[model samples]
Target: MKFKSLLAKPFAAYIYSKIQKEMMHAVADQEAILQNQIKTGCKTVFGRGHRLDDVHTYEEYKQAVPLRDYEQLKPYIEKIKQGKHNILWKGQPLYFAKTSGTTSGIKYIPISKDSVNNHIDTARNALLCYMAETGKHDFADGKMIFLSGSPTLERIGGIPTGRLSGIVNHHVPRYLRTNQLPSIETNCIEDWETKLDQIVAETIGQNMTLISGIPPWVQMYFDRLQAKGGKKIRELFPDFSVLVHGGVNFEPYRPSLMDSIGGAVDTIETYPASEGFIAFQDSREHEGLLLNTNSGIFFEFVPAEEVFDENPTRLSLKEVKTGVNYALILSSNAGLWAYNIGDTVKFVSTEPYRLVVTGRVKHFISAFGEHVIAEEVEQSLMSVAGAEGLRVTEFTVAPRIQVAEGLPHHEWFVEFEEAPQDLSSFSLQVDRQLRKRNIYYDDLLRGNILAPLKLRVVRKNGFIDYMKSVGKLGGQNKVPRLSNDRLIAEELMRFLQ
Candidate 1:
C-alpha cells in the first residue's frame, strides 16, 4: 500500500462520518457558523459598521448585514486595491483571483491566507469524501493530470492575480505535485491553444491514473490525442480510471466523453467557484452533490422564486425545503459578507444535504413572463438528443426580441458532435420538451407571445472558435449556457458566418 493512500483512507473515512453527522444536525451547524463568521469579522470596517460585535444569533446577523453582489462590494474592493487593510476581513489580502465579470470586463475577488487554507482543505475533503464512500484508491498510486489555468500570476496592488485554478495550483501539496503532469513551463503559457498542445506532449506518454478538468476541455484533450494517433484514451494510458470534472452540467457531455475514453470510468463532479470551494459528489450510491457545511463558509438561501424581490426572505439550512430552487448566498472566511453568488440550486436530499445546481440568477430568461433557465434548456436538449440518437457538443440560448414583423422567441445556437438526420424535427422535439417542463413557456406559445424556440445547427468547432475569440478557451471557463439578451447569440452568428 502506498503511503499516500494510507494517510488518505482514514482521513476520508473520518470526514465521511463527520459530514453525515453535520448534515443531520445542519440547523445548529449553520446557526453556529453564521455567528462565528460575524464574530470573526468584528474587527473589520464592514463588521464595525454593521454592528457585527452585537450580532449573536442568525436572526441578528441577518438583520445587520444586507445581501450584496460584486457591484455593491466594488467600493470596498477598490479601497483594498489601494492597499487598504482590515476592510472586509480582519487583515490585508495577499492575492486577488481575477474573474470574468457578469456584465463587464473583470472582477478582482480578494483571497486571504485564511481563506486559501480553507479552499485547499474543502477541495481535498471533497475527493476524500468520495474515497471514504467507495473503497477505490488505485488512482492515487499513479500520476494525475488536471487541466488548470496558467500559474503565471500578475501582480495587482502588490497582490498576486490570476484565475482560481491558478490559485489552487500553487497550493497543491508537495506529495501529489511530485507526480503531477504538465511542467511549470507549460502551465505558464498564456494562450490556451499553445498550452493544450504542450500539455498533450507532456502527458501522452505518462502513466496517468486520473484526469481532472472541466468536461469540454478534457474532451478537447481527448480529441487531440485521437487526432494525433487514432487510438482511444484508454489505449494510450491503460491505468486511466478516473475523470473528475465540474463547472457545468455533465449529462450533455457524457456520451461524447464516454465514447472518447472508450470505457466506463469513475467520474466525480465538484462545485468550486472563484468565491469559494462549495461542494462535491460524495458517493456512487447517490447522485446529488454533498454541500460543505463545515468548510469555513456559512451558507444562506433565498428562494429563486423570490430572488427578484426587493427584500427576499433569507432561509438557513434548517428552513430550506427540498425541491424548491434557491439562490445561494454565502458569508465566508474570504471576507465576503452576505454575498449572493447568483447560482441557484434545488435540494435533492436534506439528510446528507445533497443538492443540484439549477441555474444562475442572471442566466435565466423571463421575457414575456416565461422564466426559462439553463437546467430547463439543457434537460430539454438532452431528452430530444437521446431520443433522436444525436450528440451535442456545445450550445447557448438567447431571446430574439420582438420586431415589427413577428413575435419574439428563444433562439438556440447549437454545435453538434452528431447532427440529427432532420434538423427541423430535432428543433421541434427540443421545443416540445421545454414546453412540457415550463408551463409559462407553454402558455406563451399557446398565447402567441413566443413564435417557437429557434435552433441553428452551428458549424463544427464553432464554440471553440468563439471561446478563443473571447480569450477564454480553457480552464474553468465555459461558454455561457444561456443569456437573457441576444448579445452572445448575435456575436456567435457573426463569428460563425
Candidate 2:
C-alpha cells in the first residue's frame, strides 16, 4: 500500500516509465551491437584479420565467434592505444579507463564514444531514480562530491589513460566538471601518501554537499578531516544532503561513517562495475537495489542451488522471479557477452526486477574445507558490533590451518573504537554465530575436524598499512577476506608473527 502511494504520484510514474523505456532501447541497441560483433568474429576466424572491427552480420558471427577475455583482446587494445580508431570502433574513443581486476596488474579498457554516451545516460538514470523517490531533481542547487580514485590520468607502461574515476570526471556534462575539485591532481602518480595529501588539500575550502565512492576510502578521508580539527563537515558543507557508495558491503563500516556525518543523510547504494551499471538504491527501506535493465545489458542468473560451472543454467530477464539467489552474468555493448564477473545476487521480485547482492562467488574461504563467504563475515561483524554496543573501525577474517599438528581453526583480526569487556568471551560469541550461519563450518564442528575459533585485536590502520606495503592500498584493489587454507594460513603466519 505504501509503495502504491509512492508510485501513484503522476511525476513518479512518469519518471519510472521513462527509465523503463530508455532501458528497453539500450537492450535493443546492445543486441544489435553483439550481432554485428558476432559477424566480425566469424570473418576473422576464416582468415580476415583486416576486416576485423568492421560491421558483421549475424550468420557470419554465429558460425565462428568464441567467448573472449582480456588476454584475447590484448592485440586489438594495443591497436586502440596507438590511436587506431577503426580497430575497436568506427570513431575515436573519448578516453581509455584503466581498470584492474582480480590482480594487481592494470587493464586499459578503452572508453568508446558510445560508452561515454552510456555514462551520461547512466548518470541521468541515477538522478531520475533519486528524483522519483524523493520528488527532488534540483542537483544544481547544491554541491556534490564524488570520492573517486585519484583523478590524475596515469599512463600504463606508456599511454596516458584515465581510470574509471578520472574518465567519469573528464566527461561530466562539461559544466559540473568545471566547479568540481578532483581527488587527484593532473599528471601526478607519486604514491598513495602524496595522493591523499593532495586530495585533502583540495577539500580545505570546498563546500561539497554530497559525496560518493567506496566507503572505506571515504571513511579514511573523513578520518583525516577529523584529524585536521578546525573544519567540521556540517559547518563546512551546510547543504550536505546525501552519501552514495558502491563496490562493497556497507554494514561493517557504517557506525564510524554515521558518526562522522552527524545525522542521517539520504543514503544511496549503487552497483557500478567495469562491466556495466547493474543497480542502484531504489527505495527508502533499503529493501532492494533496483536493476537498470534498460541499459544495453541483457541479464542472466545462475541459481545458488548448484555450483557455478562451465554449463550452469541461466535465467533471462523474462524468467527471473522473487526469492531466488542467483549469480549475475551480463552481455553488454562494451564487448563482454554472457561473461560472468562472479557477483552473486538474489531477486527480491521479478516484475519491477528488484534484487539484493548475496555475495561474491569467487570471494569465499574454503580453508580446512569450510566454505566461508564475505556476506557471512560482514553480517557476523555487523550483528556482533551492534549487540555489544561496539563501534568497529575495520576488521578482516583470516582462516588458519593448524600448524601445531592438530585441527585447523578460523581467526578474526578486529580493530574497534575501543576494547571489549571480555575479549575471549567476545571471540567465542562471534565464532558461535559464524559456525551457526555457515553450513560447512557447522559440519566441520560436528565432525571435530576444526578447533575453536581465535581472535586477534589489531591496531587501527593495520590492514591499510599491510595493503600499502604490498602496493595495493586502493584503486579498485581490495584486501581478500576469504581464501583457501593455504593462502590464509600463509598470510596469518606473517601477520601473527
Candidate 3:
C-alpha cells in the first residue's frame, strides 16, 4: 500500500468509531444542539423580535419561531448585510454563499464562523467512513478531482461571497492539496465548457483515483475525456476507484456512468446543500444515508402532505417514523430558525435516523390532482430502462395540460445514450411503473382525468444546451425532475428529435 493510504487507515478507524458513537446517541445529540442554539438565539435581534427569551422548551421554541423560507427571512438577512451586529446570530457573518434563487433573483445565505466547520469536517468524515468500512483508502495516494465551481470570491457588504462548493474549495486540507487536480487558474474559468476542457487537459495523463461531483456533470466530463483519448475512463485512469456524488438521484445516470467507466467502482452518496451537510452514506450494506445529528444543526420534519397548511405537524428526531414522507426543516447555529429548506425525505430506519431524499417541495407535478414526485419518476424510468438494458443520459417531466386533441398528460423529455427500438412500448412500461408507485396517478388514469404520459426523445446534449442557454450549465445547478407547469417542457420542444 502507498504510505498515505497506510497512514489513513488508523485515522479512519478512529473517526468511524466516533461517528458510530454519535449515531447511537443521535436523539440526545439533537436535543443538546437545540438547547444550545436556543440559548444563543435569545441574545439576537431576531430572537428579541420573536420573543425567544421566554422559550425554554421545544414547544415554546416552535411557537416563538414559525417556519420561514428564504424570502420570509430576507428582511433580517438584509439587516445583517448592512453591517448590523447581533441581527441574526451573535455577530456579522463570516461569509455569504451566493446561490441562484427560484423566486428571488440571487440569494445570499450566511455562513457564520461557528457553523463553517460543519461543511468542511462533514465531508472529511464521509471519506474516512468509506475508508474504515471498506478498507480501501488507496485513492488518497493518487490525484483527486472535484469538478466544482471556481474557488473565487467577491465581497458583498464586506463579507466574502461565492458558491458553496467554491467556498469549501478554499478549506481543502494541506495534505490533500498535493494530490488535488486542475490548477487554480483552470478552476477560475467562468464558463463550464472551457473549465471542463482545461480539467481534461490537466488530468487526462495524471493518476486520477477519486472523482467527486454531481453525476450529470461527472458524466459530461467522462464523455469529453473519452472523446479526446478514445479510451474508457478506467483505461485512462486505472487507479480510479471511488465516485462521490450527490445533488440528484444517481440511479438514472448510473448506467451511462458505469458504461463510460467500463467497470465497477465504489460510489458514495451525500446529502449536502447551501444550508448544511445533512447526511452521508455510512455503510455499503445500508440502504439509506446516516443523518448528521451531532452536527451544529437541529432537524425537524413536517409531514409532506401537510406542508402547505397554516401550521404543519413538526416532528423531532425522536418522533420520526420509518416510511413516512416529511419535509425537512432545520434550526442551526448559523441563525436559521425553524427554516424549511424545501426538500422532502422519507425515513427508512428510525433506529439510527437513516433517510432517503424523496424530492423538493416545489419540484412536483400535481396539475391533475395526482402529485408525482421526483423519486417516483426517477424510479419509474430507471426500472424500465434497466429491465430493457438501455441507458438514459438526462430527462425531466412536466405536466402537459393543453393538448390539441387528446386528454392532458405528463410529458417526459428524455435524452438517451441508446434509444429503445420500440419507443411506445418503453414509454408504456415506464408509465405503468409510475402508476404502480403513485395511487393518485393511477386513479387519474383510471378515471380518464389524464392520459398516459407521453415520451419525447431529446437530441443528444439537448439538456446541456438548454442549461447553457440559461447560464446554469454547472456548479450545483440541476434540472427539476418534474414540475406542475409546462415552462421547461415548452422550452424543450425546440430540442425534440
RMSD (Cα, Å) of model 2 = 5.5
Per-residue lDDT of candidate 2, residues 428-494 (tens digit): 7787788888888889888998876777776667667766767776565566566554453344344
- Runs off by more than 4 Å, candidate 3: none
Q: How does residue 208 of candidate 2 score in lDDT? A: 69
Model 3 pairs whose backbones collide: none
Per-residue lDDT, model 1, residue 484, is 84
How high a TM-score does candidate 2 get? 0.82
2 against 3, candidate with superior lDDT: 3
Off by over 4 Å in 2: 1-17, 20-95, 137-139, 154-160, 183-190, 230-232, 304-308, 485-497
Residue-level error in angstroms, candidate 1, position 91: 0.9
- Report clash pairs, candidate 1: none
Looking at model 2, report the run of 10 residues with the lowest lDDT sum. 38-47
Residue-level lDDT of model 1, residues 27-95, one tens digit each, is 677777777778779989889999999988888888999999899888888888888889998777767
- Highest lDDT: give the candidate number: 3
